[model samples]
Target chain A: MSNWQWFHRLGSPRWFYYKTEGWVPWLAAVSGILLVLGTVWGLAFAPPDYQQGNSYRIIYLHVPAAFLALIGYYVMAVAGAVGMIWRMKMAFVVMKSAAPIGAALTFLSLVTGAIWGKPTWGTWWEWDARITSMLILLFLYLGIMALQAAFQSRDAADKASALLALIGTVNIPIIYKSVDWWHTLHQPATLKLTSAPTIHSSMLYPLLTMILAFYIFYALVLILYTRAEILRREGRTQWVIDLVKEEAKKP
Target chain B: MHPVRRQRLFFILFIVFFSSVAVGLMAFALRDNINLFYPPSMIVAGEVPLDRRIRAGGCVRPGSVSRDRETLETTFLLTDGIVDFRVHYTGILPDLFAEGEAAVVNGELRADGGFYATQVLAKHDEKYMPPEVAETMAAVSDGHDESCEVVQYGS
Candidate 1:
């Protein structure tokens, strides 16, 4: 089909819902498998850093979580924008589904970074640029979630939250560039498309694999959450009622 | 304004206040990156230039630690495999620091490569020792004392 037609279909809640239903289980399975394999490869097989030795292994978890935290915010912001601009119900569903997950990933990044920092930088915390910006990102995610829950009307809440998300996007660039803009003890980017990786092949391979695995996991979870949101939002629809009844009939 | 718009305005104001404070702190701490990492061996070799912010790292020499009579300062020797350099700091040490432990000091190098430290970091925890230290100990201890106690210190 044409690109516009494909996008048009995606913009429809019913079409998006049915399409995702079939994909979620497979995506979840693949995500789980890749995550397990990648973690083992990173934790055990990867050679230790020449300087840091085994403690550097924490980067596998730290970097991936940080990457996902930033990416999740973008996902939320873009979804919010789409919902506001096009008045698409599915877009709202996506925005709502993304916030808590993004918050969780951001929290993971902060905690893992703190743990890794203790061994390498000698302190459990620093008010460094990247670290500080990431903390703000977490608060932004929390704010969106809280605003949505505080409102009585779902539509009004979604619109308000989306606007907040769009505004909060200013911090995303700040987070990405904080290492350069300010003096941070946190090392610069290890993986860059234009330059060679700073690490050895043995270590870099597993890190890349784990990053890919993280993206797949995000997609899998997003789909699952979106499906749940669909069920909750469309619970009054005949199809949803029928599905619920059919499931009830099952042994 | 609509209730949604009013709510958004409040959120925006809140974010603005926090972001400005974060940015202000970051700008104040800005410094050169290369100046931030130095091993004691590098310092002894006069590799770090004087009066520039740099980090010096090495194992804390077993018996070279002494406290300053006045001020929050302390003096100790940091040693890598081949060389040792004196480090002086006037701030709080990280919680994990102790004799024979690995550490990294951030500050400036003197003209003579003696490090005048602004910040100090103990390298690892009891559960997570730096590999460099473990390897050094392993090499030195070869078939000797295999029962050396792992070090831990409370902040």
Candidate 2:
């Protein structure tokens, strides 16, 4: 019975709000410190490439943003599925919060990649398979966001956007494997789950740090957004009203 | 499980499965357009039409690049381990363009069998290393680095 307590409490908006409230400061501090450390190490300490030179340093940002964008889509889709199947409002709030963050990260990846590509690949943009598939991913994120806004009813919006998010997951595998499957100007991935990473240790370490920082940063932002969304959706509840009163009385 | 919940679960699964099948079929139908370039073997086999603007990519064959010096005209042979073809371009090459490195050229194949490229873009591999590591590997291997052997060509 005790084991299921946390799981049951996780579905409650009030419980989630109070549980994560104490974690906000810690999450912000850790992510901020790790982000600064990763960026400084990647830029100043890491060695230059033999070929691409300084332009290759952009991987610290580009790779992490791209990695999180793809992972965030899965988060959004799974949250939507949970909401649809289990009828959980918290899940729907999470799904909604994930959409804009994923879209922004995907946009970041594209812009950083274009900046890196101009000096290395001799072009700012191309309709190559990998690049085109990534662009499609960006559009998929935007489409989900747009679909959510189109419906006036929150319930209708959740259901419609959930369906679209699940459908768009098919594009994720395509984006990941496009470089390998097609003759693209975009190079293949440096990190592989099945084998050892291709990047050297000095470069790989900072990249791993940045990836960790991005994951922590994502968690912090998701929690903040979910907390705000919970308040909005549960405003009529007594606990939320009391919370608002408590906050006003503090100062 | 509740009957309604079970029914919704099945409905969601059905949508995902059928949508994946639909997308797979569409991807298969547009296969050629999705590939960025053709390899040398495809060009050698006459699978690609001549005199049409198309993209070709392969490793730049070592010791095959020649420059006119007076003009921007440069010629290089690109190889895919199986076949090799000559590419003629009259512009500045990219910074990363070098012997034994992968490159993609966009141009038309003349009836005379030479490819006249209007644009040349350098393509790098997945491997990354610091300058010192690369230099050490280059010295230890002495002109026979494993990086050159992993050149990927279009299938």
| Top candidate, metric DockQ | 2
Please report how far candidate 2 places residue B153 from its true position, in Å: 14
Alpha-carbon shift of residue A123 in model 2 (angstroms): 0.9
Query: Which lDDT tens digits does candidate 1 get at residues A1-251?
Result: 48579867877767877888788878888878888888999888877664566778888888888889899998998888767656678888999889999999999999998987876667878666678889999999999999989999999999889888877887887788775565355656777668776566777778888888899999988888888988888999988888899889999
Per-candidate RMSD, Å: 10.1, 2.5
- Label model 2 with its docking quality class: medium
Error of 1 at B130 (Å): 14
Report fnat in order of the candidates: 0.13, 0.75
In model 1, where do residues sit more than 4 Å from their true spots? A1-3, B1-87, B90-119, B122-155
Write candidate 1's Cα lDDT for B96-134 as tens digits: 577776776778887765788888876542122334544
**Sequence-dependent TM-score of model 2:** 0.95
What does candidate 2's lDDT look like per residue over A59-127, in tens digits? Answer: 999999999999999999889888888888888999999998999999999999999988888888989
